[model samples]
Structure formats: structure tokens, C-alpha cells
Target: MPMPGKYSLQPALITVADQIGFLKQFFSNCFRKGFEWTEFFRQAYNVGYRSTGIIALTGFILGFVLTLQSEPTMKQFGATSMISGMVSISVMREIGPVIVALICAGKISSSIGAELGSMNVTEQIDAMEVSGANPMQYLVVTRILACTIMIPLLTIFADVIALLGGFTATNLGGAMNPWLYFYKATTALEFADVIPSFIKTILFGFTIGFVGCYKGFHSNRGTESVGIAANSAVVTASVWIIIIDAIVVQFTNMFVYA
Candidate 1:
């Protein structure tokens, strides 16, 4: 006879296997017939344009606070003029992408999970299959592709907004030329700093979409499962974001920055 707790890992292992199968299905459906272009564009608009306000606010605050906090330390080191470069590099390389991705993981991921979970519970997904429609293409692929395409663009937008915010914070102490500040910031960023960060944001976006959809689609057939799916999506996506960021940073250090 098996021990009482011997099968504790079974559920986790099953979940991992299920997720892998779902990922495989997603890739397979990507190249299948009946790609939903309209849905894709709609999801893209919802994911990208609708998110600008929060991203802008977050970016501005991030840059402004970072500059203010670093001013004292830089002054002590007689590197006040390097503040713009420092802020730009920090935002472009690490802070901007990771922070924006986390925020999206909370907002976008939860929204997708709740929406899909509700559909699943209401039998809408089943109804679609009965109607001979590809729910995976219309729902999952559109959402996942939209997120994968939009997030990097959003991150770039956030980076620019952050630089402006940093400039605003810099001027609070004294007047500085806008052109000079921007020039310094731009010069501080290099090809190596940008490419890796961009790659990470793309991966972050995909992970966010995949986890959200998977949780929602596989949620139990109950109203309560919708909430659980949304919450789980946020938590799982956030954890994955951090893990991917750590792994990417390590690889970048080994290959790009080395």
C-alpha cells in the first residue's frame, strides 16, 4: 500500500504536464487554417491602447522617484551630471520592462483569466465547439499573439515616458536644458542594453498570456472558479516574470555583458 502523503506531488506533476500539452496545442494552432485577424486586432487594441494610461502613470512615477532617490547619493559622489545617464540606463535595461510587465501581469492577465474562466463555466467554449468554430484560434491565439506583440511596444513607450519623468524630477532642483538631458540619456543606452531587455519583455508578454489563458480554460465548472482562475493567473504570471527575468539577466551577464 502507498503511504498517505506519497502522492502529494502527483497533482503538481499533472499540472505541469497539462501546461506543456496546452503550450504545444497553442503553437500548433498558430499555423492552422482560419486565423482570426479581426479578433487579433481587437485584442491588440484592448491590450495595448487601453493600457497606455496605467503604463504612462507607472513609468512617470518610476523615473521621477528613482531620480529623486538617487540624487543625494550621486551628489555625494560628485556625479550629479551623470544622473540622466544613470536613470536612462536603469530604466531601459531593467526597471522599465520588468515593472511594466508585472503591472500588466496583474491587470491584463487577471482580466483574460476571468473572462475565459467565465466563458468556460457558462459553456460558451463548448457551445463554440458545437458550432464548428475554433475557440482556440478565435480566443486563445488572438489573445496570446496580441499580448506578445503589444507588450514590447508598451515597454518602449514606458521607457520614453520614464525618461521624460526623470527630466522633470531633475529640473525640480534646478534648471537643466531639455535637449542636453535627453541627449545624455540617449547616449547612455547601447545596443547590448536594449536588445536583451526587448527580448525579455517579449517573453514576459507571452508568459503572461499563456498562463492566464491556461488557468482560465482549465478552471473548474463553477462560478467561483472564475475568481480563482483570475487570482491564480496573476500570481503565476508574476512568479514566472521574476523567474524569467532572473534567468535572462544571468544569461545576459554571461553572454552580452561579459
Candidate 2:
């Protein structure tokens, strides 16, 4: 038998290997023969439509606060009129996707983890397995795909609403036409500014879904494991979102900005 100290390090290595295996299986299931369109649509509606209010509110407040904060600096430089463009670029390029994604991580990731954990604990997954239903396809694949589809759309929605919030803020200290504000905002953005950030949200969505599902689906059968799964899912998904954002931004900077 292994020494006590030697065995202590094994769990960490095993966990790392397990995570790698989970990722491979997730990707495989994603392309498996049976595509559950009905479940996908159902999950999409739940993840997307149900998330609108929070996204809108987050985008709005984010823009509102950023505009207010940047105003003093703009006024100091006598560039107050540039507020619209500044706010637009900031929201579209960074704030919108990251903030919305983090929020989704907190809200959707935890929900999915807890839901799956509860199902796992109750042996519902085993029941489904015995009844000829593929839980991985129905639950894991559908939710992951739904998140991947919905997050970018949500980010786009958030960006627009954020710009509207910025416009309102711009008008607070001085009068500016809505058309002029929108035009400035649009003109300030390029395909480069938009595309990479949009791409990041897809990764964010994938990370959120994968982490949540992995935590829940693999949770130990116990009443307390449900809470542990949800909590772990949120924390892990949020870290993955930040890490992915950093890596994507680094690549985008090298290629696009450099």
C-alpha cells in the first residue's frame, strides 16, 4: 500500500484527470447522434427569455454608473461630449459580455448545478437511464448547447440596453440628440472591437454550462451535496470566465491591436 503522504497527493492528480475526461465526454456528447431539439429549445427559452430582466437591469446600471464615474474626468479634459462614444465602446467591448456572463454564472450556473445535483441525489438520473433515456444527451448536452446559443444573444441585448442607459446619462448634464448619441456610439465601434468579445461570450457560456453540469452530475449522493454542487459550480464557473476573458483579450490584443 502507498504511504499516507504519498496517497494524499493522489486525489489531486485524480481530480485533474477526471476533469479532463469529463471535458472529452462532454464534447463527444455534444456531437452525438441524437440531437434533442425539443429539449434544446426548452432550455434556451429558460436560459434566455427568463434571464432578460436581470440582464437589462445589469446592463443599464453598469452603463449608468460608468457614465457617471467617467463624467468628471471627461469634464476635466473638456471632452464631455465624447461620453457617448466612450461609454459605448467600454460597454460593447468589455463590460457587457463580462458582466452579463458573470451574472449568468451566478444565476444560471448555480441553478443548473443544484437542479442536476438534486436529480442525482434522488436517483432520477438512474431512473432515466433504466428507462432507455440518455441523461447525458437530454440534460448535459441540451443545457450546454442552450447556454452556448443564448449567452451571445443576451450579451447583444445587454449592449444595446447599456447604450440606451449611457444615452440617458449623457443627456443628464447636457442635451444630445438620441440619433447623434447612437451614431457616435456606432461609429466608435469596429468589427475588431465586436467580434472577439462576442466570441468570448461563447466560451463563457460553455465554461458556465460545463462547470455546472460537471459539478452536479458528479456530486456525491447526499442532501448537502446539492448546496455544495451549486456553490462550487458558481465559484468555478466564475473563475473560468475570468481566465477565458484574460486569455481571449490577450490574443485579441496581439492580433487586433498590435
Candidate 3:
């Protein structure tokens, strides 16, 4: 007979296997016929357009605060003018993508989880199946694809706004010409810095969609489970964002730098 401790490990292993199966199914469904273009466009607008304000605000604040905090240290070394370049690299290569991804994980993941969980609980998803409507194709495929496409675009927008905020913060200390500040900022960044960050955001978006959909789709049938699904989606998605960031950074350093 297995020990009690060994029995406990069985469930965890089974859960991991089940999740892997779920992901495989999701990807297979994503490539099926009868793609919903109208729904995809609507979801894209919902994820990208509705999210612009919060992303912009977060980027602006991050840029402003990062510039202010780093300025004093640069001043100690009498290299305060390098702040523009430093902020640009930091925002573009690391801070902007990670922070925006975390924000999206929190907001978008929870939203998807709760929405799907509610539909699951109310039997709306089942009803669609009964009526010969493909819920997975219409619902899950559209949402996951939307997140995959929109988050990167949103990240680019955030990078631009963050640079603007950095410029404003730099001006607060002294008069720096906008053109010069932008030029320094632009020069500091290259494709090596950009391509990896962009790739990571795509992973982040996919992780968010997968976690949210998995949690909600598998949630227990109860009103309380809806909340649990949303909460778990956010928590799991955030953890994944960190893990993916670390892995991407490691690969980038190994290959891109080497």
C-alpha cells in the first residue's frame, strides 16, 4: 500500500497531467474550422481599447517614479544627464513589459475567469453545446487570440507613453530640450532590447488567457466557485508572468548576449 504522503503526491501529479491535457485541447480547438472573425474583433477591442487608460496611467507613473528615484543616484556620480537613456532602456527592456503584464494578468485574467465561470455555472456553455454552437470556438478561441494579439500592441503604446513621462520628469529637475531627450532615449535602445521583450509579452498574454480559461472552465459548480475561479486565475497568472519573465531573461542573456 502507498504511504499517506505518497498518496498526497498522486493528486498533485494528476492535476498537472490534467492541466497539460487541457492546454493541448485548447490549442487544438484554436486551429479548428469555423473561426469567428466578428467575435474575435469584438474581443480584441474589449481587451485592447478598454485597457488603454489603465495601461497608460501605469506606464506614466512607472516612468515618472523610476526617473525621479534614479536621478538622485546619478546626481551623486554627476551623470544626471544620462537619466533619459537609462530610463528608456529600463522601461523598454524590462520594467514596461513586466509591469504591464502583471497588470494585465490581474485585470484581464480575473475578468475572463469570472465570465467563463459564470457561464459554466449557469449552464450557458452547456446550452451552446446542446444547440450545436461551439462554445470553445466562439468563446475561448476568440478571447485567447485577442489577448495574444492585443497585449503586445498595448505594450508598445505603454513604452511610448512611458518615455513621454520620463521626459516630463527630467524637465522637472531642469530644462532639457524635448528633442534632445528623445534622441538620447531612442539611441539607447536597439533591436536586441526590443525583440526579446516583445516575445515575452506574447507569452505573458497567452499564459493569462490559458490560466483564466482553465480555472474558470474547470471550476466547481457553485456561485462561490465563480469567485474562486477569478481569484485563482489572477494569482496563477501573476505567478506565471514572473516565471516566464525569468525564463525569457535567462534565454535572452544566454543566446542574445552570447
Candidate 4:
């Protein structure tokens, strides 16, 4: 048998394990039942509409900054003409996807965490339980489902804006001859690059939603826990994105080879 001290912390560990199990079950149930469309629309609006300005601005800056930064390098390579194609490729394949994910993790995850944490601390969740409602279904399912549905849309929108930014930035050197820039950018892109990227973002959305809800739902340390939940949500969501991305790349490559 374990020592008394060793066994003493077992309950806390068990609670954590139980919470993880609950999350998995919650996720399964949400997918199975199909989430509420009305609630989903509301939550999606919250996650997407509320954050539109930021995502657009970020995309714009990302495109502009990337072009500006690459101009000198491409010129050094004596390949200044490659700048538009290169920037568009980067934006669509990686920068737009990853950066938008990070931003959503920061903005949406924190908001969800704090909102849920507040509800938890205030006993609103308990009240729902007392009222004979599945709190997880009503709250967790809605937000998670919302993220799943909305993140991809947001990413696509960001990619467009980033491309626009790149176009505007390139115009600084000369009128980038819109037809050539668009053609090169489009021709250089393949389904492999575009499809894999958007697919990865679904998992990214799941991570942000899962971690945010998990932290907040389990946090009960009073008002203080709200802040803790928010902070942990952002941190965990961002970390999980990178870890999952690495795994996804390897796993996807195997499938491609297979």
C-alpha cells in the first residue's frame, strides 16, 4: 500500500481525472446530439462577430508586416517578383491560420474562461443542476460547438484580409499588376497546403474551447479563481495548439505517405 502522505493526495488527483473524463464525455455528447442552433448562432456571434475587428486588423498587419519584412530578403535573392507569391503562400498556409488561432486563444478562450468561472463561483452552474438541467449541455456544449463552427470561418476571413494587406503593401514598390500577383499566388497553391491548414484549425478550435471550459468549470477558488481560470485558459490553449500542430503534421505526413 502507498504511504499515508502518498494516498492523501489521491482524491485531488482523482477529481482531476474525473474532470478530464467528463470533458471527453461532454465532447462526445455534444457531437452526438448536435448542438442548439440558436445558442450556437449566439455563441458564434460572440466569438466571431465580437472579435472581427481584431482578427481583420491582425491579418492586415500580418500581411503588411510580412511583405515589408520579405521585400528586402527577396530583393537580396534578386527575386523581388516572388514577394507576392511567397507572402500569399505564407499567409494562406501558415501565418493566417496559426496567428489567428493564437489570437482566438487569447481573446475567445479568456472570455469563455472568465464567463464560466464567474458562473461557477456565483453558483449559477449549481443552480442549473438544481433546476434539473444539464449544465454541461447548456453551457459547455454551446461554447465548444460555437468555437468548432466559427474558427474555420474566422481563419478564412483572416486569410483574405492578409492577402489584401499583402497586395496593398506590394503596391508601395509598384502597381503589382494585380493579374500576375493573383495568378502566381493561386498557381503556387495546392490542395495539400490549403486543405491541411484549414483542417488543423478545427483541432485548434477544439483545444481553445476545451481548455478554456475545463479550467473555468473546475475552478472554484472563489472570485480569484475567475482570473486564474482566464489566465490558465489562454496559456493552456496556446501551448496545446503548438503541441497538437506538431502531432498533426507528423500524423498527416504518415497518412499522405500511406
Measured by TM-score, the strongest candidate is 1
- Model 2 residue 249 lDDT? 95
lDDT by residue (tens digit), candidate 3, 1-258: 856584477887887998998888778888899899999999899889999999999999888999999998999999987898999999989999999988998899999999999999999989999999988888888888899899998999999999999999999978999999999999988899999999999998888888888888888899999999999999999999999999999999999988
Ranking by TM-score: 1, 2, 3, 4
TM-score of 2: 0.96
Against the unseen true structure, what C-alpha lDDT does each candidate score? 0.96, 0.92, 0.91, 0.86
Worst 10 residues of 3 by lDDT: 2-11
Candidate 1 at 254: error in angstroms? 0.5
Q: Give the Å error, residue 116, model 3.
A: 0.2
TM-score of each: 0.98, 0.96, 0.96, 0.90
Per-residue lDDT tens digits for candidate 2, residues 1-258, read: 855585587888888899899888778888889889999999999899999999999998888888999999999999987888899899988989999999999999999999999999999999999999889899999998899989999999999999888888888888989999899889999999999999999999988888888999988999999999999999999999999999999999999999
TM-score of 3: 0.96
Which pairs clash inside model 3?
none
Two-way lDDT contest, 1 vs 2, winner:
1
- What TM-score, to 2 decimals, does candidate 1 have? 0.98
lDDT of 1 by residue, 1-258 (tens): 875486598788889999999999899999998899999999999999999999999999999999999999999999999999999999999999999999999999999999999999999999998999988889999999999999999999999999999999999999999999999999988999999999999999999899889999999999999999999999999999999999999999999988
